[model samples]
Target: MEMFLYYIHLFARNVKRTPLFFALVILTLSIGIGTLLANLSMLSLMSTDPIPGKSEQIFNVNMNTYAGANNRFGSMHVLRYSDAKAILDSKVANNATMHYSSMVYSRRADSQDLTRYASPTRATTASFFEVMGAQFAHGEPWKNEHSNNIVIGHELNVKLFGGANSVGEKLELQGKIYTIVGVLKPWEMRPLFYHASEGKAFDKTDDIFVPIEVAIDNNWAVFARTMSTDSYTTLDQTRQINAYYIQVFVELLDDKQHLAFQTFIDGYANQLKEKGNHRHEVDNRLYNVNEWLDKNEVVNKDLLAFTIATGLFLLVCIFNANSLMLSRYQASQFEANLRRAVGASKKQVFFQGVVESIILGIICALLSFVLAFSLLALYRQLFDELAPVAELPLHMLVIGLGVALTSSLLSTVYPLIQGTRTSLASILK
Candidate 1:
């Protein structure tokens, strides 16, 4: 430990001798590392499983139940209200829920402010909380599916009630009053699997979740894609019409449950076929969380391509840094020879260089963070659509540090070897 400290002290003295060279090395390394880290941070966030252990157990339901051959999306993964309700009522899976995206102007019912904020809402069933593993900070999911009770997400809770326990509080939406049955804890799910369509996969969780029956009865406007052969006048007509807009998710505990649920969906598809509802053959499919994200292509392809490009750029940076390190070591060769003449071994000289590289790595890591933040801000401006999901998580932060340290050490290897290998007498002359 004492020798290690002494080596670090020697490293500091070395840096003091050529501060410009040291700064240049760190700046060069930080630029490359920071650019790569920014891309990696967004990619990692996008690819992360929203629900870890239960991801495999939960699946997104997709069935080819649409009547038209020229489907806009070419995939009949979305469900009609009737079909969605039927599946939800089946109770075949351990837990199942169906939902559609809706938006409403909302405010606290008791507040003096008449202003209403446009809130992203979900018209879902009570099982949604259980299926999605959403935890409540106060109260619980509404027991009455037809009642006016609703659940508010943490962000909404913060906005309206100042982040306090908001249960039993009344919320007004479009001139209607609804009781808040639950207040969600801080829940953030990236690549929101339930409604991954229409470029909403990376969107935050809904501000409000209301019972599907209540949402329909109250005529909440659908904020999502609704396809129907017959035009619907109101949300209430959605149940009776063949309008396809809802999305369904179910939790099947094991392969047996998954198979059974698949079989059930197939039977239902056949029923639709027999009834002249569906024109095509039964093509019901269930995708696990990760599979669903892949199907949606939630992680942008351009981001992946950019990540690869940045990786190559980092290699180029390493080469440039190695060349700079070689030049710095060559200049210090006389000093290394003098130390060897005073009884310092080659191994000792090499160890000191390694310690110096590690110190440089630490400095590089700090500078890389500042550079990464600047690059990420630029990225948010360039890619506004992805701005919300661009921030770094703890794991990505640690990864950035590891990449910096590894890069610095890698660039020093050849330079450190050459610096220690030359004959002492020849270098001194």
Candidate 2:
């Protein structure tokens, strides 16, 4: 108990002597620690799955062909509704979902004038909702049995129907009156992979979804195409669906099954190509759940690399602080000599130094947490374009506290040791 009181006195005396230097050390350490904690929080939030279902089993398949004039690089393609149907019916995939895109016109129920929007008017199978892990806000997704039913996003629902429950409500698209079956909850929009690669954003915020069979029955040219009669084309009737653009997705049970399925798809595409049905080339670029997360939700490679570099830089700062502390203790040789001459024991003098170091560490830790929170908020505000507010996670608070405590202890270690080693006799000489 007496020892603790002595240490406290020592700490108070040291602070009185060098208040400004102590403040500077703590500020530099806090900034470095705060930046690291913020980045770790951003990385964690973006890469984790929002849904807890079996996302690992899901995968996306694109139609592709390797035939351009260069022939060195293959051109990717999307499947038509007919080709997608053949793959689904043959049970080549354990389960499959398909969707195609088109532009459509829409308007508010009260408004007479039509407003044209470049929406992804997708024709999809019933399983698409299940495959993509989408949740319906009010009613169920459009049923395959209901030909004229459609599901619209929450944003679209608000724009077209004033945000009312629009189940069984009517809306017009491309001269056809369709019944609204469901509305989707607001979600972070992502560009489709193929389109994203082409520098286009697949903004599904205003999208409308319908059943694939219904689209074909209505002879939607966006879902399928027929060749002109005047052309002397000798392509097989089965291969007539060259111009249709559709994306196919599959779900598998395990990695072994996934590889087997991928191989089969490759061979199947090869057979089609050999038979002169090769307008679009097929390539084997499949994504498991982890890969999908990395592509869509995780931080970009440049950001990740930059974060690591900054973390290393902070470590360097901590080391530099250690060196500075050691130098300060060594420069206090006259103080050590006076304490020794005043009959202070070697153990008493060393314990006093350790106590002062501990006090400084505690002060720095408290300041670091405050600084970290402020810096994190500023970081989100400044980089809102690259890192959204949604990227911040609650766990960052815990992580920041830990970083602050750890950094303080580490920075104080060298100073504490150097202070303890100062000899009263050597200092007096």
Candidate 3:
């Protein structure tokens, strides 16, 4: 520790002598490290499993159901309402659910005001809450009354029912009276891993979660996919075999369940093929949370490109740091000669140089963290794609420190080696 403190003191003195040069080196390092960290933060946020415990169990379902070899919907990422319903009906997995995004207006039943706001909704099943680990702050999910009962989120509860429990309270949605059966706790799933394909991955939690049957019966309009074989006069027509617009997911744990689910998918596709209605190739896919995000590219591609660029910039910064350190070490040749003459060994000089590099790394890391925050904010502002992104966690300080120390050590190897290996007699002359 005493040796380390002495090295630190020497490092500080060197920096005090060449303040601007050291400052520039630190700034260059900060820019490189900060940019890299920002992109890493985004990648981490988008790729994290939203449902950690259930990610392995739950799988997103995809099938090529479109007829004809050149159909646009062939090899797409959605299923027909009938296909999704069939998968759920097969019960091949432990639990399963499908949902589609919709907008519905809601108002307090007792309110005399004619005002209402369009609520973003999830027309899902009771199993959805279980599959997604959605916590309930109030009542439980409805048992018998699926259509007439609704689940409201925390913000919606505050807006409609004054932040009360709101269980059993009457709320009117799309001109139909429904009882609030449950109120969700504050829920946020970044990249909305389950619904990434629908373009609502970063959207706010749904204000309403209604039964799929209720959503279908009430004719809730869908904003996601709607591929059709023919024009539909009624909303029910879209729910037919020809129209494909539902997102399905199943929870298959053991190999038995997986095999069963896979068989179900293949058998269903074969049935359609045998019936002469299916023309496209049979392509059924199942992806977990991380796989789903990867398949859908939830992480912004530009951010990934930026990551690679920042890595190269960091390499350049390291080279620059190495060059600057070479100059600094060369400037201390007189000191090195004097110390070597006073019986300091080459090993001691090398250790001192390494300690100085570590000190530089420490300073660089501290500066980079502050710069990273600013850079991240600025980057998010400049790129609209990064809007509504999650921020880096406080624990990223450890990562920054590791990066800085590793960078400094790597940058200093050649310069320090040459500086420490000087001939004492030649230098004394």
Candidate 4:
């Protein structure tokens, strides 16, 4: 501790001699680290698996069951209601859920309030809450088979009921009174992996979760794509073999279960082929959560390109910082020789240089964090498409500091060696 303090004192004295040189080095590194950190924060948010514990266990099912000349929907991930029902009935995996999204305008029933709010809704089965690992702050999912029961998210809870536990309350939607059975906690799922292909990955989860049967029975207007081979006049006609829409996810607990589930889906496809429902050969694909995100291109390509570009810029900053460090140390060569003549060791000189670089690195890290915030705001304002994933998390602050410290240490190596090796006789002569 005393050695570090002494070295730090020596470093402080050197900075006083050439403050501008040190400032320039730190500023150079700050810009590079700042840009890299900003992009890295967004990239990490997009690529990270929202459901960490069971991501590997969950799999998305895709099949080539479309038998039409158009082939618009190449790999049919979204299935018709009939196809979804068939998969649910098979029950070959540990757990699975089929769902499609919609948007609805809802208002409180039997209330004096005159405002109606537009909310995103999820039409899914009971297993959806379990499969997606939803946590509840009040009430729970419906116990019986009824479409009148609904689940509301935290945002909706705040909007409609002033953030109260509105479980037993009634909501009026589409000229119907529905009972709220559950209220969710403040939950955030990045790249909402379950529906990444729908372009709502970075968006918040639905405001309401209702039964798929009720949604099917009433024919909820399909806000998303309802791909079909045959001309369908209504959403109710989506149950036909020619139409495909709902997305499916299954949970396989072990390798045995995975293999069995794969075989089951493939066989189901083959059976459809045999029955002449599907003309294509058996072609089915399954992707785990992380794999699904990659397959669907969830991360912004422009953000990734920015990350790579900023990474190269950081390298350039490192080179420039190194040159500055060499010049600073070169100016102190005579002092270093005199100190050596006065019995100072090479290790002492080296430690002093190291201490200075580390302090500069620490300063750079702090400054870079501020720059990162500004850059993130600028990027979001410049590109509205990447706004959802632009914010930085706490962990990223540690990463920025680590990078700054490491970069500074690396940049000072050659300079430290050069300064510490100056001969005493050369200076005395």
Candidate 5:
């Protein structure tokens, strides 16, 4: 109890001598560490699917090659309806989903408010929702029997009919009127595969989705072909869909089952090639469950780099704090010698120095928390336009506190040892 009081007195005296330097060291260290943690949190949230399902079992199947008179560079790897039917009928995959893209036009009650712009719209099967782990915010997705039904995104509903409950209402798409069957939740816009080829971010803000059958009957193969002069014919087409853009996702029982499924797909692709059905050749690149977890390599690399840099920066701050503490000890040389001469033991001096460092560390941690929160609030306000609803998770706060405490202890070690080594005889002369 008596030793504790002495240590407290020593800490208070040291802090009173150098408040500004202490605050600077804490602020710099906190900012560097806090920013790194915030970025890591964001990356983690974005790369994960919110739905509770086996997302790893899902695979994107594509036909990667085509045979023609001349090798074409940008030829599509899509299969036709017949080819998809054959694959699905074989039950080689756990589930098969077909998709196609088209330009959809829609309008509101007021023709003036109506927009007729080209949007990359999708025509997909009902299993698409299940495969991608999407849910309806209001109403349900279209049934297999409902050919003329449509489901719109939340933002699209607002733009077309100005309400969320636009279900059962009629909307015109591609010069055809269809009843709105469902409206998807905001986050359901994930796994936008179309943007993969376009090299752009898929904003689910404004897109119209409809049944695959309706799209095929109404939009697919509805192109005009113009013939040229001479015996050789030239075809000028507006939209020609020669193949089907379908992806088959499978959910196997175990690792062995997964490998078996991949081998089956490989064998199937070879069979298609042998049969000259090269357009339906399956791309055997299977993504297993573990691979999905580590999909965001860029994000992972960025987070790691940020963490390493932050750790280094904090180390530099600690070294600076230690240097400052050393200089202060040098100035108190006479005082330390006087105390030692008065019969204070080396252990007593060492304990007092450690206690002083502990007090300074606690003060720095509290100040750092305040500064980190302030910086995060500012960041949120500034980037509200870009990531309006993004936030740092609660776990990051715990991590930040751990980092601060650890940094404090490491920084104080050298200074505490140096302060304990002062000699009474050399200083008292």
Candidate 6:
């Protein structure tokens, strides 16, 4: 420990003598480390399991009932309303929830301020809260499925009620009065598995949630894609039509339940085939949360390619630092040889170099954080849709430090060897 501190003191004096060289090394390495760290942080967020423990159990339902082309992959992730309702009514799974996205103009019902904000809404069933593991801060999910009662997200609550518990308060949506039965706590689900398709995976959670039936009754317009041969003017008309819009997710506890649900889905498809409602072959599938995300391609391929490029850039930076350190060490050969002539072993010289590299690593790591933050900010500006995931979480911070230290040590290896191997007789003369 004493020797390490002594080496550190020597390193400080060396830096004082040639601060510009060290500064250049640190800047070069920080740029590479910071860029890599920024990319990694976003990638980590993009690929992380939105639901950790139950990700394997919660499944997204898909039925290849598309009339256009039955064998087309990824064409049937969304389901028709009837299909979603049938699956929910079957009671085959441990829990099930179905929803369709919508948009509405909302305001406090009794507020004298007539201004209304455009709100993203989820027209879902009562089980959505439980199935999605949403945390409630004030009240609970409404008991009545078709009632005017609704739920508000924390952000919406803050906007409407100043973050107070506003349960049982009245809210106006598109001029229709609805009671708030629940207010959610601050929660974010990355790669939002429920609606991962249609390029909406990284979007924020809906500001409001209402029962699907009530939404239909009130004619809340569907905010997502709806495909049908028949023309549908309202959400109610979507119920009986062949329009494919709603997304369904169900929780099955075990493989047995999963198989059972699959069997049931097959039987249901067969029934449709018998009734001539479905002309396509039965190709029903159940994708767990991660599988669903993969099917939807939630992780951007372009970002992945960019990450690889950043890794290569980091390598270039490492080599550049190595060259800089080589030059610095070559210039210090006189100092190294003088120590060797005065009884300092080659091993001791190498150890001193190692300690100096470690100090440089520590400084590089601290500076890298600032550079990484700046790069992340730039990424957020360029990729507005990915702004939510462009953050340095705790694990990514640790990884940055580890990478910086490893790079520093690696860059110093050949330099240290060459410095320690130099002849001492000339310096002693």
- Residues 332-419, candidate 4, lDDT per residue (tens digit)? 7888778778987998878777888899899999999999999889978988778888898898999999999988997898999988
TM-scores vs. true structure, each candidate: 0.96, 0.68, 0.89, 0.94, 0.65, 0.94
Task: Name the candidate that leads on TM-score.
Answer: 1
Native-to-model Cα distance after best TM-score fit, residue 190 in candidate 5, in Å: 6.8
Q: In candidate 4, which residue pairs get closer than 3 Å at backbone N, Cα or C atoms, i.e. clash?
A: 79-245
Error of 1 at 321 (Å): 0.9
Per-residue C-alpha lDDT of model 3 across residues 196-287, encoded as one tens digit per residue: 88566777778999988778877888878777776776666666657777888889987788888899889998898898756787888888
Q: What lDDT does model 6 reach?
A: 0.90
Residues 1-429, candidate 6, lDDT per residue (tens digit)? Answer: 898889999999999999999999999999999999999899999999998999999999988777564445443877988889999999999999999999999999989999999999999998999899899999999889889999999999999899999998999998889999999999899888888988889888999999999998888888887777568777788887788888899999999999999999999999998997776888888999999999888888888999999999999999999999999998988888888888889999999999999889889998999998998898889888668888999999899999999999989988999888777876566
Clashing pairs in 5: 79-244
Please report how far candidate 3 places residue 2 from its true position, in Å. 4.0
Where model 1 places Cα greater than 4 Å from the true spot, the runs are: 69-73
Query: Which pairs clash (backbone N, Cα, C closer than 3 Å) in model 6?
Result: none
Give Cα distance to truth, residue 226, candidate 2, Å.
18
Tens digit of per-residue lDDT, candidate 1, span 185-245: 9998887878887888888899999999989888888888878877878889888777888
For candidate 5, write residues 1-429 as lDDT tens digits.
888997898777666777776666666556655655555455544454533466556654444444443434322324445554455566666665655555566775335656665554666776666666667888887886347888777777766667658888877776777888888776543323322232222234236677766776674421212111112211112123233344344556467766776787677668878877554434656554334334323224544576577667777776776676667677776776687788878777766776766665666656665665665577577764224223465766676666666666666667657766766667776
The predicted structure with the larger TM-score, 2 or 6, is: 6
| Candidate 4 stretches greater than 4 Å from native | none
Worst 10 residues of 4 by lDDT: 67-76
Q: What is the lDDT of candidate 2?
A: 0.63
Give the least accurate 10-residue stretch of model 3, judged by summed lDDT. Answer: 67-76
Query: Cα lDDT of all candidates, in order?
Result: 0.88, 0.63, 0.82, 0.86, 0.58, 0.90
